[model samples]
Target: MNPTWNAIRSGLERGVIELRQTFTTAQDLWGYLFPAVVLLVVMTVMRDSEVPGTGFSLGAMALPSVLGMNVAYGGLVNIAQHLAVEREDGTLLRAKAVPGGMLGYLVGKIVGIAGAVLVSLVLVLVPGMFLFDGLALTGVGTWLGLLGVVALGLVATMPIGAALGSLFPNARSIGLLFLPIIGLIAISGIFYPVTSYPEWIQWIAQAFPIYWLGLGMRSALLPEALVAAEIGESWRHLETLAALGAWAVVGLAVAPIVLRRMARRESGSSVAARREKALQRVA
Candidate 1:
């Protein structure tokens, strides 16, 4: 077998192992369910409210948006957190010590994170289907569009996460990312319609992948009439593709350079220093 293929296969196996571990580990299982449970509670509370013009349940409309948000969160924040923590723990340095290890490491990270995100989505969606009514899951087009949106969303966000992770000095600094992400969720219309927001805020929301991902999911899962609640009153699939594609192109171009530089900078002394800092914090 080719060396690169071997590395990739090893990475895939690593991902599978880690994914299984996630199910077995109590903490990991909680990490997976906590957010889903909170969102379900909120959706249940909002079950009676209706979307502005449509008679459909507001919780039902919000369900797909939440799924979209989860995709962005997993692709961006989860990867960033993992990379930062692993780097501090000397995992990246260990990978750097081997010829094809970095490739395998990255492949493993992607596979593991993507699998976790898919499982998380299923956890949310299955309960949502029973709790809410009028979800547009009838046609083949809906499923295909959803799959495309998820693929594009991950492509657009994961490299950016990798770049951000390389830049963050330690796992503790990853908390800074949460504030902005929460702010983006607010503006991205995860809980409400973007059309209800101010014109400028709507534009800002549209500028990011989160909003488009939500809109894409909504387009896939909601009735056609609900488009009245969206900005431009259309799905804007072309713009969604263009925006996500642009982000993917730029991130793919930049992440490798950033990650390579970060990896090059890693050393025994640096890892030790990080460990010392973490110990001091614990003390």
Candidate 2:
């Protein structure tokens, strides 16, 4: 058997094992459920309110945007978190020591993270469909569009996460990423209309994959009449694809180079040093 094929198979098995662990482990289960509960609560609180220019429930308008934000959020943060922690713990070094181990490691991480993203989506979408009044869950096209948006969102974000992870000196450094991410979410209109922002801010938001992902999700899930509340009274599926596809291309191009460089730098001594620093911080 080809070594690459062997690595892929091993990676798939690892991914499945980790995905199964998501259901079994207390921390993983909490990670999924807590956010869902919070989002549900907030949406419920806003159930009676309306979008700025439309009679649609503000909660309903937000449901799909929040769902799309989840995909982007999890893809970027989870993968980066896992990579940072694992690198500090010597996992990357161990993988680097083996034939095609780095490839297998990445594949497993992507699969596991993607599966986790889907689980998060379902936890929200299943309940939101019942609670939210304006969702267009009645057709095959809507469902297919949702899936397409999700796939593209994952592709756009995960590789960038990997690249960022490789740059982090330790797991604690991941905390610094949060403030910027929060700012992005704020402007991306996860819970409000992007059109409400100034034209300059709106242009900045539209430049990123997060905004496009949220737009795609809204396009798939919200009623056609809700377009009036959007920036240009349109879903602009083509613009969504172009923006996300550009991100996908850039991430795919950069991550492999960065990961390879990071892999080359990983050594047992480096891992041990990082562990020592982490312990000293604890002490």
Candidate 3:
């Protein structure tokens, strides 16, 4: 095997071990459930009205969005923050001393995040079925499409997260970046349709992967629901597939450069300094 692949495998193994140790802890479970619960409550409360022209209940409209949000949180923010923190805290350096360590770390993270996302999905979908009465899944095609959307969306978004983690290389900086992330999520049709935003904001939102994820998800889960809305007609599965592919290409292209630079900058001394700095901040 290639050295990079071997390193990645090693990293993944370590990441998995760490995840298994931490998985299902109160914090992890809470992280998975809290947003799901909020989404459930909002949808249940809003079921009475048509979301604009769509005769679909708010529950139906929100289900796909909730799922998309889970993907975003896990594949993007969570991956980015955790990687950056680890890089700063010396864990990444410790792994780097071993062959295939980086690979193992990332693979483990992906597996862990995927696991958490699955848990969150069940939490959202189970209650959504009863609470929303809005889940009207059509056929095997919908299931396949939903899977395609999730997988493709993760591919498109996770690289950006990885790139950001590599670029920032510090937890404090990563946390600061969340401010803009929040704004992007708000405008990106995760909560409301992108068309609901002004023309300029709509254009800006289209540039992000979250919008594509939401659009792809809506295409999967609410294909018929689209018939009643304005942008609904534009929610083409082919376009979603194409957009996700394009984003994945871009993310893959850009992320490695950042990671390479980050690796070059990394040193044991820097990690120790970062740890000390972090401790000072906490104190």
Candidate 4:
């Protein structure tokens, strides 16, 4: 037990190292930076509109949601996609061979991804405060709620990410995997309002974690934005909390099963054969 715990710690430390290495890699930075630029451009184009009450500007209303979306994209989607590639390349197998390897590796990733999200929030907030005229962080309660939403959002999404990583085990397949999620985000009112969508589509969006995270953010940092909603007060908060909690529960339960199956299937020769086949197919 002690050895396993130590191994977990070591894997976590190694994961952090891996994440830092990724930042230094030119391709990784380029991939993330391009989308960030696009988001900034779009936000700049959309910042002139007025938010409901509280005199908050459109930038202020949109800031929290954008932050929520970025965290989801960067933390969950990015991590999962990268892990899939790594797993296919036997990176996970290598880690599993070390002491407390898998646990440590996962812990390190969770911490690293959380750090990445915090950095992203800061990058967005600093410019947001200056460029936008009406921005505020009213009270401690609101701030706490924001923290809660971020924390909960990570917990809910990470397991699903791990499950996806374990299930798809290759970069090409993983790229294909992200299309559905991206589409969901579009339909979930990230870039637009959910009300604009049909009832069934709204229901589908509500079933997913991203929408609930956005709703929780809209509830927390942008409380005034919630007033225009048709639902009653207690129900909305309860609904947001319930949906996120339920997804977290289900994802957490399923992640281990998927991971165990992946572990069982992993073999050095099989990985080599797959890589060779992929290369051949490409050629």
Best by TM-score: 2
Assess candidate 3 and give its lDDT. Answer: 0.75
The regions of model 3 sitting more than 4 angstroms off are 1-19, 223-225, 230-232
Task: Please tell me which model should have the higher TM-score, number 2 or number 3.
Answer: 2
For 1-283, candidate 2 gives per-residue lDDT tens digits of 9999999999999998999998999998999999999999998898999999789999999999998999999888889999999999999899888898998999999999999999999999999988988789989999999999999999999999999999998889999889988899999988989998898989989888889999999999999999998889999999999999999999999999999899989988898899898899999
Ranking by TM-score: 2, 1, 3, 4
Model 3 scores a TM of 0.90
**Could you tell me the TM-score of candidate 4?**
0.88
TM-score between candidate 1 and the true structure: 0.98
Query: Global CA lDDT of candidate 4, please?
Result: 0.73
How are the candidates ranked when ordered by lDDT, highest leading? 1, 2, 3, 4
Q: What's the CA error at residue 224 for candidate 2, in Å? A: 0.6
Among residues 3 or more apart in sequence or in different chains, the pairs in candidate 2 whose N, CA or C atoms overlap within 3 Å are: none
lDDT of each: 0.93, 0.92, 0.75, 0.73
Deviation (Å) of 46 in candidate 3: 1.9
What are the runs in model 1 whose C-alpha is more than 4 Å off?
none
The 10 consecutive residues of candidate 3 with the worst lDDT sum are: 223-232
TM-score, per-candidate, Cα-based: 0.98, 0.99, 0.90, 0.88
Shift of residue 27 alpha carbon in model 4, Å: 3.0
Off by over 4 Å in 2: none
